[model samples]
Target: MKYTVSIEIAMPREEVIQLLADPAHLPKWLRGLVLHEPLSGVHGQVGTKSRVVMQMGKQKIEGTETITRREPADLREIPKGSVVHFDREIVVEGMWSVVRDRLTEAGPDRTLWVSESEYRFSGLLMRLVGLLMPGSFRKQSQQHMQDFKAFAEHGKDVREGKG
Candidate 1:
């Protein structure tokens, strides 16, 4: 399955970059995130592999996420008109996935974030879930973007359970 979702955040591109790159802010917007610890390389750097654990309802899914690409390693001085890119590959027992994220300046003080995700399942159970409820994947992606926008714009925390 593959799908793309996007949202406009009322913040400068630079600010958005900083917030997204910071592991400290992940829990604030990434709902159900229980852990995101770097296993190798520097956190957020290209080639870094992180152990990710998320609690989705009654089930807990754990995966290893590897950072495949990060454009302009230095974020201190991003030139105008440059679109920031962040790409990663995730692997678990029965599924393999990749996500590509791009952030661009939408206006003087606004940012547009686009995320494209693809998933491949192996086990029968996993494949069935992917086949029967493909829209759920897209919906979850959009929810993350919306949660991020709220967090970035209004300092809302997903864990708080209140918008």
Candidate 2:
């Protein structure tokens, strides 16, 4: 299954990209994200892999994220913001996920945050979930985007229920 979600963040595009590019601040916007640790490669560089752990209610989920691509491949260029893409494999549940994050400057202090997610489920149960309850997945993703917008724009700690 594949879905896309977008939001408008009232912050500079560069600032939003900076906040998202850091692993330490993940929990502030990634909802139930409990752990994010690099497992290989040069940190944020492409081909790097990381372990991601998340908790939703009583479910403990684990995934491996392999950085597939990044924008601004060169340092010296017309400076703006980032339009990065990454692919991840959910090891625990046999899901393939890719998310492309695009940030565009809307104004001097506003940004348009657009994210597209593509998911493939391997297991029968997961496929059932994808086919029968697609809205659930979209809603969850939208919530994450909204939470990130609030966190990035207003400094509202979404993980703390302030957003």
Candidate 3:
């Protein structure tokens, strides 16, 4: 399945980018995420890798993510937009799964973050699992977007000692 979500933050693009780039702050705002490990490469740059673990009820899945794109922050220049896309292969027990996410940003003092995910079921049994779990998946994605907005915007305030 493919889905997209967008939110406008009341913070500068640089601040938004900084918040998104930090791995330490993820669990505070990223829903379902229990662990995030920076694998390699420089922060906020393309080719950076991270190991992500997310929990859903009693099930936990792990995946490796590589930053597919990055745009530098520019204050004087107009906000041209940026995106961080992840290609993920998740494993649970003996089943192999895959998903992808694309986060995009636009507007001054604002961001339009979009997450798109595609799932591949291992077999007929897994297909049944997907069918029964549609609501959970949608809820997880929606919560992620909401948490991201709250974190990015409020995080700026907290850093400025306003929160």
Instruction: State the lDDT of candidate 1 residue by residue for 26-98, as single tens digits.
Output: 9999988999999999989999999999989998999999999999889887889999999999998899999
For residues 1-163, write the lDDT of model 2, one tens digit per residue: 7778888888877677778777777888888898888899865667788898989789988888887776664323427554544344445566777877666777889878777888888889888877898898789889998878878777778667774
Please estimate how well model 1 matches the true structure, expressed as its whole-model Cα lDDT.
Answer: 0.94
Model 3's alpha-carbon lDDT is 0.60
- The C-alpha local distance difference test score for the whole of candidate 2 amounts to 0.75
C-alpha lDDT of residue 162 in model 3: 36
Candidate 1: worst-modelled 10 consecutive residues by lDDT: 154-163
Measured by C-alpha RMSD in angstroms, how accurate is candidate 3?
4.9
Ranking by TM-score: 1, 2, 3
- Report how far residue 21 has shifted in candidate 1, in Å: 0.6
For model 1 the local lDDT of residue 44 reads: 90
How do the predictions measure up, each by TM-score? 0.97, 0.87, 0.69
Top-lDDT structure, candidate number: 1
Model 2: ten consecutive residues of lowest lDDT: 73-82
RMSD of 1: 1.0
Per-candidate total of colliding backbone pairs:
0, 0, 0
